[model samples]
Target: MAKQKIVRVDYRLIHGQVVAKWIKYHPVKRIIVADDELKNDEFMCDIYKLAAPGNEVDIISIAELEETLNKKDDDVMIIFKDIKNAKLALNSGVKLIELNVGAVQNGKDSYFVTSGVALSKEEFKDLQEMQEKGLDIYVQPIPENEKLSLESIKNKIK
Candidate 1:
């Protein structure tokens, strides 16, 4: 198995949007879900499994992420349900991967992740850390909605 190159954070997990967009956009072969809730939730994992066709999608723990996939230089897209786990995953060997913020609706107003998806205080801090680490973080829609252009995102980053 090869290493994953892209890491996405979507509260919704695998669904129609992800299957149709990122699976093809990044040409991803493996989908790794780094949500502890989903990692322990078998039923949720099953639901995610059904969404993906031929691709291998594993909902694993933040701990298992590195050992399972030693590198991040291949065709893989990692999805985390929250920023904390996403940062922990980054603490592993992951680097310079494109962060697609899928959804974080439950976050507080102070937490900035685009104009839409909310973020918790901790989540915001984690994102700041990830930024400090030099990860490429961007808020892109699930393809059904209007695309979020680089110019627009640059404003949010400022």
Candidate 2:
């Protein structure tokens, strides 16, 4: 199996920070945005592709991601729009050792977890399950930021 260098859950999938910072830090040849909604929207997918100029960007649905990952031999960074989608990918047999939680927009039911990260109770439960599954999940918007663990966030919520 090809290595999945980074599996990140960022609300803004392929933004300036991702292109300028995360890409450089991870040094992956391919960037895969795994979102069901984006897959069906060609115009949006094209925009995301354009955002990452040098590297190859593939905007694929969660269903197609598993197949795409299987055929790739290069180091790939997979980005999900939310933790639920990341959990879905994991349930579908995607092997991810670590997950970076970034930029989850604030919602009515969501609580602020860390810088650029907010999660509802349900989402937090999904994250807890992922952690139990042996995935190292942390909240870090950028490489320079401190990595906040799920345990710390859980304690804060309590």
Candidate 3:
């Protein structure tokens, strides 16, 4: 199986930060956006594909992640829209070693953990669960920014 280079939890699956920044800095042969809802939506998938013109982009359901990654022979950056989806991927045996928390939406009851990361009570708990399972979790909104540990911002949560 090819290496799953980077796994990230970003609310915006594929945007300027990803196409213009992350991809520019850490070039990957493939980008897999693992989202259940968007996977089946052909129209939205096309738009995301267009966003990254030259790269191989696949919007696949969480169920397909393991098999897809196993079959591919190139380095990939797997992205989940939120922590829940990332957890789902983990529960399904994706073997993710580390996770990068990016711009999650500051929804109701969510606390701003850092510049671009916000977590509600439940979301923080989910991250804690992942951390307990030996997953290294950190926050870095963009490539140029410094990575912040999950423990570093625990005080931000109410």
Candidate 4:
């Protein structure tokens, strides 16, 4: 792989922060979405592609992504729709040094995780597993704002 860009877990695949800031600010050449769900969903796939106009977005399944190994630049960002899917990709030999916990949705027994993001018990469990594997997980919505580091965010769990 030329580079192993960011591995972010976001329910919403593409957003303004992703296109405007992460892609433009950091200047990533490609946006790789490694999610099996989105890979199969035609509507979501179309949405992601259309949402990122003038941006190179590759939506690939975990199996397909594992066989590939080339980011071609330092600015590429690898994103996943959920933590579980991203975990699968990472275990498949994708080196993700930094992980961005983009957002979590509201649900029963869930608590406020970060700005506009909440986590249910099941989601929290997946997050704990990622932390155990030593991935730097943070809850940050916008790139420009101050971010919540892994240590700081983890402290809020227990």
Query: What's the TM-score of each model vs. the native?
Result: 0.78, 0.95, 0.96, 0.83
- lDDT tens digits, residue span 1-158, model 4: 63655667777778877887777555666788887767898988888888788777888888877554463444567788777787777677766767778766666777776786677667667776777887777777777767686556554554
Comparing 1 and 3 on TM-score, the stronger one: 3
Better of 1 and 3 by lDDT: 3
lDDT for 66 in candidate 1 is 73
- Candidate 2 contains a number of clashing pairs equal to 0
Q: Which residue runs of candidate 3 sit more than 4 Å off their true CA positions?
A: none
User: Model 2: how far is 97 from its true place, Å?
Assistant: 2.3
lDDT of 2: 0.88
Rank candidates, lDDT, best first: 3, 2, 4, 1
lDDT tens digits by residue: candidate 3, 121-157: 8998999999998899999998888998878888899
Candidates' C-alpha lDDT: 0.70, 0.88, 0.88, 0.72
Candidate topping lDDT: 3
Where model 4 places Cα greater than 4 Å from the true spot, the runs are 71-74, 154-158
Sorted by TM-score, highest first, which candidate order results? 3, 2, 4, 1
For model 1, residues 1-158, the per-residue Cα lDDT tens digits are 55566677787878777888777767877888877677888887898898999888877888888755764445777888876778777887655356767687663354454545665655656666777787767666564555453345444432
Q: The CA-based lDDT of model 3 is what? A: 0.88
The local distance difference test score of model 4 is 0.72
